[model samples]
Target: MKTGTVVGRLWASKRLPELPAGALIEVQLDHPRDVIVCYDPMGCGEGERVLITIGAPAAWWFLPGQQRVVVDALIIGSLDEGSPPTMPK
Candidate 1:
């Protein structure tokens, strides 16, 4: 899991048939220019700070029997309290 900011949303009228309902959010990773697009199960909107969990052994949990429906980041929840957690930059 990691902390990231919701930069934008990807609107796809047509997607994979097996892929479940969710939103694709653009997030800036822990590294510079490391921004990436991730499939989030949570209904997180733009500009919202969120915690993301990478798809792993849990990949089948969401996209079963298929490795193509990769969701490297999932929004766990929204941060409504203090500022976003920090790291050693």
Candidate 2:
């Protein structure tokens, strides 16, 4: 999983039938300083830090039954306010 902050939301008039019920949010990644859109089911708002899962894991975890969903990235968890624990140097 990767950590990022929710920057904004995307509105689409049309979406695939296979897609689940959720919102599409733009996230700014902590490392590499990149922005990406992710499927969000937790109703995360802007400025909230989130944890994202990508690729097959995201698709499988978010989808119900045995159907396939076109999810390149999915918001798995919302982060709390505070710095994460650091590893030993």
Candidate 3:
């Protein structure tokens, strides 16, 4: 999974029937000027740091019998008020 911060939301003029119903958000990665759009079912808000999965893993992460929605990036989890605990060296 990749980590990034939610930057903005996307609104399409027309909706696709095959796509899942959720908010499409823009996430900014650690790389300079690198950002991507991710599908969010977990109700993540802007400025929230999120864990995302990309490529085929993202599309398959849903249910088995669910329609095959072509998803490039998906927000799997969100970081809370504090940073994640680090493992000891």
Highest lDDT against the true fold, candidate: 2
- Cα lDDT tens digits for candidate 2, 55-88: 8988887547747788889998998788553334
Ordered by TM-score, highest first, the candidates read: 2, 3, 1
CA shift at 64, candidate 2, in angstroms?
4.5
Residue 27, candidate 1: C-alpha displacement in angstroms: 1.5
Per-residue lDDT of model 1, residues 1-89, tens digit only: 67777888888778776455677789876544477777776777887887766756436556445656545566776777675657676
Error of 3 at 11 (Å): 0.7
User: How many pairs of residues collide in each model?
Assistant: 0, 0, 0
**TM-score for all models, in order of appearance:** 0.70, 0.84, 0.81
Instruction: For candidate 2, give the lDDT of residue 2.
Output: 85
Worst 10-residue stretch by lDDT in candidate 2? 80-89
Best by TM-score: 2
